[model samples]
Target: MADPHERNGENERKPDSTDDANLSARLKSLDARISQASAQRAEAEPRPRSKTDSSAIGQAFRYSAEFVSGVIAGGIVGWLVDRLFGISPWGLIICLILGFCAGMLNLLRASGTIKPARYDDKK
Candidate 1:
């Protein structure tokens, strides 16, 4: 009778030093390939600036500019309406309130607290 541990006149093969060396070499080659590919991809595609890329002072200035522009534009429109309609106080007051609201909205949008509203005209 044949020995139970033997098959085809050879013992069930155990991995030898050569197998370990070959496996280590293959693994090193794979690592080198992965690193090369990663470096190439990084060079080809630069990362975009993240939301926090803006400095605190730059963000503050941007927010203030958005708010102030809305207010100034509203004030100008209101002044024009008041001048044309002869409704002095009422026109100025109503427009000032609207301007303040617009400025606040602009500020919120600029600060990323709110999404900008978009109007689409479907013809």
Candidate 2:
């Protein structure tokens, strides 16, 4: 039985020294070109802003926190009033309404829709 590679002379072929040198030169050229391209791209691109710059997501989170904190504070105060005055539902309900108003007011002020009370006090 004859081997197929032997019949085709595939196993007898060897890489030449010149072929190795040529391949090495091509690889170096490719690496240099790649590095040059990367440098140019870095120079062309704009630098990112610093962390102190507030993004849209940060502003949204701040606004939501302001509104939520107001609501939560109102709920706590209402609960306390109910507990202290021995009123079962009225105190809680009234306080909850007030809390919702406070939350809305806070949101308005934060959004610049309504001015701060201090502005009026100055006048």
Candidate 3:
């Protein structure tokens, strides 16, 4: 029968120089890949901006325009309803609610809060 020690000795033996060289090359490649991935992640992440920055002003202007447009449209609809129904202020109240909804919609659109529909050719 073969000696158990001989079998164990092979398992316990250290790898040769070629194995070490292969391991070193692999580790170097992994390190390079990790560094490249880290750089890519850093580039993809959003950087912080100051509150008083020009972009902030532009965003505020966009929101304000949306809100104002909503309010104006709501007021007009309310006036028209009031005139049609012969109601003095009921239409105004309804218009106010609609205006508020429009403003919220506009805000969502401007802020990219709402996702736009995507068309696929397969459909």
Candidate 4:
């Protein structure tokens, strides 16, 4: 059986500092090449996003949820008011219109179409 610890006569030479220095130079050269290729790739123009890349479907769901939540909240309030005041259809109708407006406003706010209010100091 061959001994694992046995070194061949040619391989028994002492480790040389020149070999270590050469190895370090080679490693630095490889690192520089890798960094150059990486920078070039980063500078390259990106391809247009497909559906999976952009995920517009998730955004659509979020917008729809925001709008629907607003409407549902308004509707609930309107229903409560109708039950409280004995106003049958008029209250419900007015509340529904208000809810739709609220939902549209919510959607606009969410989409950045509506500007947010900024408070300034009165000094």
TM-scores, all candidates, are 0.53, 0.52, 0.52, 0.51
Write the number of the candidate with greater lDDT, choosing between 1 and 4: 1
RMSD in Å for model 1: 10.1
What is the alpha-carbon lDDT of model 3 when measured against the actual structure?
0.84
lDDT of each: 0.86, 0.83, 0.84, 0.80
Question: Compared with the true structure, what per-residue lDDT tens digits does model 3 show for residues 6-115?
Answer: 67456556689999999999999999999999999999999975444358678788789989999999999999999989998999998989898989887887666785
Q: Give stretches of model 3 more than 4 Å off.
A: 1-54, 117-123
lDDT of 4 by residue, 66-96 (tens): 7998888878888888999989777777887
Best by lDDT: 1
Better of 1 and 3 by TM-score: 1
Q: What CA root-mean-square deviation does each model show from the true structure? A: 10.1, 8.4, 10.0, 10.1
- Best first by lDDT, ranked: 1, 3, 2, 4
Which window of ten consecutive residues has the lowest lDDT sum in model 4? 3-12
Alpha-carbon runs more than 4 Å astray in model 4: 1-54, 117-123
Q: The CA-based lDDT of model 2 is what? A: 0.83
What lDDT would candidate 1 get against the real structure? 0.86
lDDT of 1 by residue, 27-117 (tens): 9999999999999999999785567646878888888888888888888888999999998888777887888899999898777677668
